[model samples]
Target: MGLGKLLHDHAEHADVGGTIDHPRAYELAAEIGFLGRRREIFTRLAALSGVRPGDRVLDVGCGTGYLTRILAPIVSPAGRVTGVDASAPMVEHARRRAPGNCSYQVGEGQALDLPDAGFDVVVSSLAVHHIPAAERGAALREMFRVLRPGGRLLIAEFRPPTNHLLAQLVGMVSGPAMRHSPHDLLGDLIPAAGFHVQDEGDLPVMLSYVRALRPST
Candidate 1:
């Protein structure tokens, strides 16, 4: 079985990409996959999110609350960071490590339980491809719905390496989900969801990101 299949819970919807059940194993894999630069990379992601000290932030598919933990200190004192994931186990694991300003719940990206226009920022990292392809549009729409006008959004996804051998190796390990080019995976989804595209570019460590804003008007 591929590493992805090994880490994924088979009980989850077969149509969905997969939900990780083993938090510790997933954490270890993430650390290894990122080459021990997970913290620095995630810190950059948090910065790209355009979150402020008083901005309410939401993290969709927040595996192990890694990004949420990074965001908590940024949105400290008064602001709150809420993380939602499809895996109950992952949510529970996140809850155990959550900071004072962070919280977590079991939820899916396509059908968020959050209120409309409730968040100033929404960020999802390495999570979009996990949503079933049919539901990805709905998930983007949900992100649009939960953000206040002019709210920022940052989405980061895996970028397959340019080297053919390395890309194939990544596919073999992570499954087909990570094999897609971020541009092809996200094409028109953000704009179709009513977000104004701000910037998009490749980041270090085989990551690609898109930043957008909810229209103020």
Candidate 2:
């Protein structure tokens, strides 16, 4: 199959944004060389989500459904999990690799077809950087629209300049695509998009996270 078909097919399983070949969080999971770290991260995201029985869940930019599938059991039989991404191949891979309780959708972060207040939790990892810097805020607004009151947004990304020379150097070795993202700025942007920032933490310096909650209007 052609590259496009491969990517599309993968999107059927995971959340892939576009043709851009960017370094994803899975790469870190791979470097860890085990599902344990991935599972740990997924669990943290799920627990932080505050998902309850019968609560609908949306995994925005849910690459490979790692976190999305983990949420399936939390939401339980009554609740549902929808994973939206832009690539067919990623989504396809996610579908094949994930549990049956989760479903996948092909779409952009800036425009989701899901209804207003449709999800109890929306989490994305290493996806905001792939989107154009100008479009990141817009995409965040879209995430807000689909969330139910009291829903939470958790985003994890690599903070830059921790080792600026090292990152650029690694980019040189792994090619430009391996370069780190501007994870530092997201904390400020989250509130600007309307959510209330609840906590901000770091993961071994290179990775940082921001958690925000939507207050009932």
Candidate 3:
């Protein structure tokens, strides 16, 4: 379908949930690049997650596969990288741009249908905030479920809004669900998801990254 149809489809679902589908998804991709945070955020996430040459990685909510592309080379010849998004259009778009070693699938963060204990690392960038407040915990638990014991999970998200005005603005642009995201409560959320917190810190423009691990038991 044409971009028009793609965008129309996105609009149909925009308010139903917090999805950046089609044209807006593409627009956000460009906007992040313009701010120079696109590359920086994913790079830092990769580093913080410590993805190695042979690690099997999953990029949850991997809209259009930008970060999946970045990870393909890092995992290199032996490793595999899979990118999954709830938006089928985004998954299709991502597949077009993905490398040979990278794969794209249609999936949801709150209930991934992937095999359990399969990936060595899972990274989600600025995506989970789109999940409704009530569903965010289930999403984190799914991320935990997909990782192998001792595997790593890294997430990059906007920090909690600094003021009521900013908070309101975030809700308008991102969604109401974002206000209740793990941004401010990572210390607790990560552990509740059955992860051991490894590191947490700020990124550019009110964004933050968290690194956690599934216990090796």
Clashes of each: 0, 26, 0
lDDT ranking, best first = 1, 3, 2
Ranking by TM-score: 1, 3, 2
Indicate which candidate wins on TM-score.
Answer: 1
| Candidate 2 TM-score versus the reference | 0.77
Say which prediction, candidate 1 or candidate 2, comes out ahead on lDDT: 1
- Answer with 1 or 2, whichever has the higher TM-score: 1
**Which candidate leads the pack in lDDT?**
1
C-alpha TM-score for every candidate: 0.95, 0.77, 0.82
Candidate 3 Cα errors over 4 Å, as ranges: 1-16, 23-25, 28-34, 160-187
The predicted structure with the larger TM-score, 1 or 3, is: 1
lDDT of 1 by residue, 179-205 (tens): 678987888999999999999988887
Q: Which residue pairs collide in model 3, if any?
A: none
Q: In candidate 2, what are the lDDT values of residues 69-136, reduced to their tens digit?
A: 78888888888889987766567778887676789988878888888888888888656755555667
Off by over 4 Å in 1: 9-16
The CA lDDT of each predicted structure is 0.88, 0.67, 0.76
Give the lowest summed-lDDT range of ten residues in model 1: 8-17
